[model samples]
Target: MDNKVPYSLPGMTESFLFHESQLIEVGLNNAQPEEVPPPAFVPPCISIDVSHLFTTDQIFPTRDDLINWVHGIAIENGYVVLITKSDSGGNGSRKAYVMLGCEKHGKYVPYRDPDLVEGTRTQKTECPFRLKGRPMKNGIDRDWRLKVMEGTHNHEPARSLIGHNFVGRLNSEEKEQVEKMSKSWVPPRKMLLTLKENNPLNLTTISQIYGACKRLRKSLRGSLTEMQHLLKKLDGDKYVHFERHEPGSEVIRDVFWAHPNAIKLFNTFPYVVIMDCTYKTNKYKIPLLEIVGLTSTDKTYSIAFCYIVNEGTDDYVWALECMKSLLADQAMLPKVIVTDRDLALLSAAKQSLPNTSHLLCLWHINKCVLAKCKLYVGTDDFAELVMGKWGEVVDAATVEEFEVQWMQLFNMCKDKYSNFTSYCSTTWLVHKEKFAKAWTNHVMHFGTTTSNRAEGAHASLKKMLRDCKGDLATSWDASHSLTCNQHTEILASFERSIHRIDHIFMFPFYTNIRGFVSNKCLQLIDDEHIRMKSYGGCDCLLRETHGLPCGCELAGHRSTTLLSINSICY
Candidate 1:
């Protein structure tokens, strides 16, 4: 019954006997069952016996000093220890002592309000961590000594103390840095980085920085409200500020302001101006109307900014009226006012400056048309074709040509894209005269047919602001700084226009107007001269649109030794 046999192998040093029972035992124990290692050696919640760090032999100069020393040790070990209780003992009834414990040491009691829909959460863990600081035995020098009461916590210590309200609070020096950096418009993140770079132990958070900034702004406001502070700052800074209040209330409806130099620039170059509304530049959620003008040296300058209650006709009228008030003379109103097709602003412009011609920004119209028609078309290829054709219609050089191009576009796309053609017919075709080059070319717009200038000014202003949630006073401060820098550049440009001339502009044809006109003007004349040589004729669009001589005029002027500066139009 044993069933045993003797076996031998070539590489074996000894022979062994095999049995059915032995083989079964070997199979059962094939690979020794993997050993389960014991769990990791976890240190206690309080890794080090920091109680040894707090010594009764050490005496602090004051009670606050003792508390600070203990708290600092707790913070280093990744926990916040705050004062739980303190006995001043002013009447000397008992010795003065302060109790400190973990910030998360209390028990949460349910305090639900019947009127409220939800209950709030709490972070209390009923931790039993505690320390005590009391006056020294002598009690004559006001010195204090520290003693550990409960050295253990019921919970694990934090791995890091960031975002802890107590740890995130800024100290006095850090608060001063934040206040200064905020006025300079340094972003909160940057402020945090700077603080950390100065002190690696700083645990300040962005929310805390924001809270500090809010408090600082509120304090700066003194007894005045946000709007009142804005008005006061504007007045103190000598800005030309105008505000319209509600009929029977003191609440402001619309407010406008312009710098003194801005008004002067407008009076100097009142030929072309552009207005547009930008959003998300303030906390009020109100639209900011940005008005800009062009200089003779081809620079864009911000003329004014308005915070309107709404983009309604009445609001726009008030803003435009404020703009009109900056004119040196009623006759000196801008000859051309470029804006997007905001119907309210368009009508307001007409009412405020009746003599000024209002033209729609062609770029905005084209952008809108492309975005809308692309959605209607099925494929990207067809969408591109539609835009190409639309561009032709927009760029038609004459009224007759514009009509012809439009007809071609409709016939090509009408059957399959009826929605596209209908939208064009109703929305854009009715306002063709405002944006189409065929009509816009007839006006002296000085080649500015879009509101890109105002867009650029907005981009620059917002870059300086950095944050959209700034108050009106902060926005005005940024704008004031921008205006000062812009005026400096403009002055330097004027000086160059009078003193500097390019080598290409030394020809006799530019002799008389070379120094009197801007280098930009001479460059335009030079360009025209080249065009006359390249092309045999010119359409004279420049002569009509910008009041500058075209290539054809340049050819006739070749007979004259010198051209007069009067030939160049402002």
Candidate 2:
């Protein structure tokens, strides 16, 4: 059932062809009736030697010239050579060499290492099919020439070179794209999928792309260790201090970094800051603690970041102490620190910045309440009660009113819902002053009631990184890039406020605000402007919420009810 085709080597014509079965049949018919035994079978030559093609003064003029020479020697002998590796370095040689690997399916095991670890390495296609080359410095050849090694290849010569990697090397343009995207942290599979849009399908594989990426990384570092490069970078950083394992160990347990510009920003806008941690972002097996400060524009700026040994109280305490050391001034300490309800971390913050008011993330508290209430009530009615009724109580306007609504809810759920009751008395009551809206509104928390700043930062970091299992060097590089991008965005916002703002507030009070505060703060004042109509009076909660005067307060100034508008200024 086999179809036969006339075959030829590279640069050679097709040879005579005959059906193998027909040839056997014809030989049998012409044989003697006594049919003597056939001669003993002999195997073909396993490798070709080309040492005679080179001399002391010779060299390969170009890559193609070397290939053509090798092919010319083998093509006449029923073989076609393929280049497995080439290193021209722009001069078509450098210690440069082209390797000859057996074509696909032409690959075979070396005579050595038989019975290797089953399924682990024995199945690998590491054919002993390679030869090195270099330019002939003293030979008559123009640039370079290849020499045949001493040992013969242990396997039979390949029949043809139709599907060989040597012939299917990547074109110049594709190699460029692979190198570019790989450095950008683009996955190899994604690089191929993207390139395949403009090229033939199956043109490249993930293995090839990954190889190129690895090659580039190696070339960039030459022979230096990854740690050597990292330490070299740290030498230039004045504000970032790293703590590695004792004297000669390999582990990097903790590292704290505060860019000089970030320190300046912290000094300028130290009123509100937040600390949050992200995990599984690096192979170093440490948690990244991010300290973000809220700018007057309500934008988030990275104040500092550190890698913690663990998420324990001592680890967080060390991180905060490092931050304090970076500032080296108590006045630069944040007036209010916002974070999730990590009690250990909160305790550390208290010890580190005794003057700083600690506030729990309102969003986290609400989410926890919703989760527990759903489990307690286990009905649609309970969800409605928690969301509609309990939500109002949590957002109560004053401490007195909050206590009243909380008691009412407690009275309702104290007996029937054991889970709900235990959560209230044990959890909510213990941390009510930190998490509840009633107590938190008194602090100037930059209006950030959630950990979304940290969450968004984490999402951006993940997008720039290929995987969470990257080494410490990889994570540091990615984080540095994102920090640059964030600062650029912050600069753009500053430009927008100065050059592109549209001030809708025409009144004198609003004009004073527009000139005095940031564009983001102006927007907050505008929201209060809208709220004053619904809840009229100087005692409006808007003043309490944002530390800004309400329309009622402005009206009091207009009607001489207050001596000075400065009285309303927080």
Candidate 3:
């Protein structure tokens, strides 16, 4: 009889290892190997010796000082010392002692709880390193003495303790230093460097600085919630604050604030106002609407800020109304408001400031035009060519020139890039008067063409506010400090314009306005003079738009100054 097994099982034919069995039966085997367990962790052989540092003769001024000194030595020797137990008495009835041990001294006891998830696994190995501290009397001085209980550890010394939670905490003094620097808006990395410089043994990390700051904020808030504390601080600071809640409910919908100095600056230079919204400035993810004003020296000042729950038209109208409340006199209302192509903002501006001229930001319009055209074209050269023609359309000096240039642009792109041409016609061409030089040059925009001033102000504010996860009160503090610094610079500029005159302006035509007009205005006049001298007479657009003498107006003679400080309008 043949004792050979069948090639496969009847039902489990696909599962049978026919080839393997055949090889095994014929002794041509490459059989399966036995399973092996994973390798166990082997502690490093090199151990740190810290027993000599702890002695009964080395007494500390207090228990805290003793613990701190012991921990410092342990950390220096590549290990951490933790307080395992302590005892205290109201009277001198019981002796006070503190049991110190290695961070990995004892085994972790797992708490069995069905409701709570299991804690993360630990590296505890019942380390044998231990020390003890007790109150000692030294010549009428109450001090503490340290004694070594066990000198050796079961595990290897730590190579670095940079992230150890207990080891990287900031002491009381360090925390105070961090608070002072944080109030100055210093970054976390710089805070860490300062700490390290102050104490070479400090293992504090940047994350620890952040935690301490968070705790400080929490403590400052006390019993109040973030919003309540914010309102309290705003009221305390005498800020012009406004808040709105959902109709028929207590949920807050929006908040607005303006510093007193900012209000004064707005009242002083309220001719041209620029408004825009920035995002990711607070924990609520609300949109922050910024209103910026231009000074006589061309410096941009933040007028107000609003945290709105939504970017809807009604929200913008409410914010605008809050700004309108700042105007003590109706005649001081802004004559021109510059903004991007946000239809909601545009409608709000029209509804809120009916008499104010709403002008579109030319920079934003050009950016949009370039971005949309880039999507249709394959090459940058072609895109730039289209932008060049588009520039001609916007820069035309007259309505006739604008019409002719617009026709040229339409004809050039109508055949090759229809999508871009159509986008411009539908989206931008309708709003030409707001951004085109032909119409904008006739309006008194103070020679402002874009919302770049507002954009720059946003940049500065965000830079001061390095993190977006801050609370409302934190945001307010940062902006308040920024406004104070801005006012200081503005006042300095005003002083310079009043008293100091640069040698560059030491010209016969600039004699009368030397110490009265701004350096920016003098520069403008000087540029116009150079242009008139180089290229002959041109359209006096500056006089009509900016209220300043143009190259054509200054082309006559150079006997004396042609303009006074009051003649130059903002």
- Score every model by TM-score: 0.80, 0.72, 0.87
- The sequence of per-residue lDDT tens digits that candidate 2 reaches over residues 1-570 is 754435645765434444566556666434545568678344444554443543224466865676666665555443445666766545533355567643321434445554562454232233344445665553233566566543234344457533434433567888888778866777778887877787753335566666677677667667767766655555655556656464588766677777777777777777777889888878766788888876666677888878776688878888888777766577667677889989899889888888888877777877887888778876687657755667777788678998888787877777787678678668766877776678777765657777788778888887887678766666666777777777778777767665565656545555444434556756766676566656765554555555655567655342211222223121
Better by TM-score, candidate 2 or 1: 1
Candidate 2 to truth, TM: 0.72
TM-score attained by model 1: 0.80
Lowest lDDT sum, 10 consecutive residues, model 1, at 559-568
**What is candidate 3's TM-score against the reference?**
0.87
Model 3 lDDT tens row, 177-240? 9999988999889999999999997888888899998898899999998889989988988899
Residue-pair clashes per prediction, in order, are 0, 13, 0
Instruction: Go through the candidates in order and give each one's C-alpha lDDT.
Output: 0.82, 0.66, 0.83
Off by over 4 Å in 2: 1-63, 68-101, 104-107, 110-138, 143-190, 193-202, 218-228, 237-239, 242-252, 506-510, 513-516, 533-535, 538-542, 556-570
lDDT of 3: 0.83
Q: What is the lDDT of residue 304 in candidate 3?
A: 94
Error of 3 at 231 (Å): 1.6
